[model samples]
Target: MLTAADAELARRETRVTAFGLVLDPAALRDRLAARLPEAPRAVRVDYLRYKPGTSVLAGLVLDTGAGPVRAYAKAFTPEGAPEKLAKHRGLAARAAAGAGGGDVSADWHSVVDEPAHLVVGTARADRRLPGVGQLAERPGRATGPDASVRTLRYKPERRWVGVLGHERPARLLKAHPPARAAAALAGHRALAAAGLPVPAAERVHPQRCRGLLSLAWVHGTALDAAPADERVLAEVGALLARVHAVAPALAAGREAAPARPGLDAAAAAVGVLLPGLAAEARAVARTAAARLADRPRTVVHGDFSADQVMVAADGVWLTDLDQVRIDDPLADLGGYLAAEIADGRVPPGTDPYDALAPLLAGYRPCGARLDRRALAAHTAAALLRRTAEPFRHRHPDWPVRAATLLTAARDLLEQP
Candidate 1:
């Protein structure tokens, strides 16, 4: 637990890195006044959570005389790396030198960088990580579980699927949950309507300031561990094709995927966090992003892999809709194949592309075409992104594993 003073310090540091200024209640109030003068009361900023390497000063709620605004403010060290921040400071200096300089409202982008905010804020705002016991007694929403919240997965996001005595049916509690649970709820309905097989979303709840999404639990083992063979892999590909076929229809009113983190952002994220790999990460990101530039776009599972698909007697069920987006479909394929390769599911020294054959065979039958360049580019990006996580989580083999992935990414990018 972070002390109030510690939280405040983190907030200040985050603001400095995010924007070239430190913001407090008074500063925030003045800025709000400038942006929307109707609210004149002092701003109350509450810090929710901060996981330094991953995000800084996340989950903030701004309460003003007008209303309460929830903002997920995250400043990654790389984004705030001394060099990048210096440029922003230089911009601030130039703006300040002008008559209307230093005013937060003067630069609309700084005060309201919707892209950055939405990318970090929406994610951080709604979801929280808490223990299983804490959840059963959580304020506002508490259910005395018949059994422990049997956790399913605990990386990138926390999840559990189990029974609540009164609910009778099995239920799922997804944590570090989504900021856009409502959006996801809508998405689930749309996908179901489109004839895709997805587990239903029961409800969205906030437990003790933490976010939770209750889903109608579907009992199945992940295909990665289930009785999966080539046919199963092909079926997975076909299912993905089905998703693509109806993605445009399901994506109504939803935002297209945000821009890829790209080389600069990736470099910055890794550089800021790892420091030792700053230069190396920058060079890698630059090469990878350049290679990945401009591919055809389609609906994609933003975080697809074998593990996300569940197999049961009924059929194959797709899970984790939090990252559904409009991007290159090959991104989904690349992510899946990359995971297979990295996890050692693919035999060592075997060409990863060879492993993609059965999937492509299934996919192409559904009228989708594959671009070799796009596939290679996105696959490399996926591998490179994997390298950043170990460092953030402080895994013991992060150095060796990161090096291996970095090399693989570089090799992919340089391939003819």
Candidate 2:
């Protein structure tokens, strides 16, 4: 069980990142006060994204003398700080001149370029994030008309996803760091060529879309949000079966993410956050590593979850296809089920098991053989890996939530 001391340890560890100064709200308020039009009362910042040693971005509500202004502050490597700030200054100038900037309307885009914070890091991820918005709104592109680019998720210097339209998005945009964008494009093409139910990539003018992957809008409610309907579940099961059978041959040029390292990393993070569960977390990962290796390997969604599934009348479509690579096929199943159970992913008042039964029922007849023991181990590992999520996602009671997830993993492992 996690005591008060254990929770304190977890909170303290969050402040010890490589970019410690950039992640500190107090430091941010001081550093940016001079840059703003008027420095006044206070600043409230929440970590939007943090990738150790690479980048960190914060969303802030600054209490200036004028009023409150919401802005994003992206980290920069010391070597690139001058260049990055210059670029933003240019962006501010353009906006001030009324030319506008990014995907935000020309009228209000200036808010994004001011009161920036600087830090030593790898590169500027925030640079092209707004550019994808520009590409989405431009005419004669893969982006259909009238859709707006709303950021769905962001991990600085890593990857970002934007939905160009809401709920049933008119277009989808996945942006990567300049170095990794090409591989992402290749991965999408490979899946599309294999006749998977992947969304079609839109063809945009090549001039300004360097690190952006734009897709024709996919129309469907997310699977986790939709009712646990039988038809969609069966379709998902069959789709996974096909992908597992065909993925190996198709994976020669694609990425490979083995289960062992990911599990080991998860265990280490849990050890750091909840010392009481360190031994148990290690056991979960070790057992999962051994069991996962015994099974035949195939391409797996490295981060599969209910959110990645889109249920439409025609079929089940997979979103966030960037991590599709070779690994234990059961990793996909374990991940999906782990999120469903731990995240309370099913609709309100619905038991996750009620959803799980029909999903397994649909899965069994689809030519895929599952090892229940391995699935259990992987699910436990998945839960342990996600122990930090509540904290990362800004839950007010993160310590309790993280400890409860750790306990769930232990229970899953201890079960007969």
Per TM-score, the best of the predicted structures is: 2
Q: For residues 1-416, could you state the per-residue lDDT of candidate 2 as single tens digits?
A: 22354336535544323244444556656765665555536766544454434445665555655445444566654544566667666655553221212232222232222223353111121454534434423423435554445555555445656666654656777767555676666556667778888887742444654567778666788888998787778778777776677656666666555668988888777676566778877887777677667567776656778788888778898777777777777778877877876676633222234545666666668777776677777777788788877755555576677777777766666666
| Top-lDDT candidate index | 2
How does candidate 1 score on lDDT?
Answer: 0.55
Per-model TM-score versus the true fold: 0.63, 0.74
lDDT of 1 at 201: 70
How many steric clashes between backbone atoms does each model show? 2, 2
After superposition, the stretches of candidate 2 with alpha carbons farther than 4 Å from their true spots are 1-34, 37-148, 165-169, 202-209, 346-355
Q: After superposition, how far is residue 21 of candidate 2 from its true place, in Å?
A: 8.5
Summing lDDT over every window of 10 consecutive residues in candidate 2, give the lowest-scoring window: 97-106
In model 2, the number of clashes is 2
| lDDT score for residue 208 of model 2 | 56
Q: Clashing pairs in model 1?
A: 72-121, 95-101
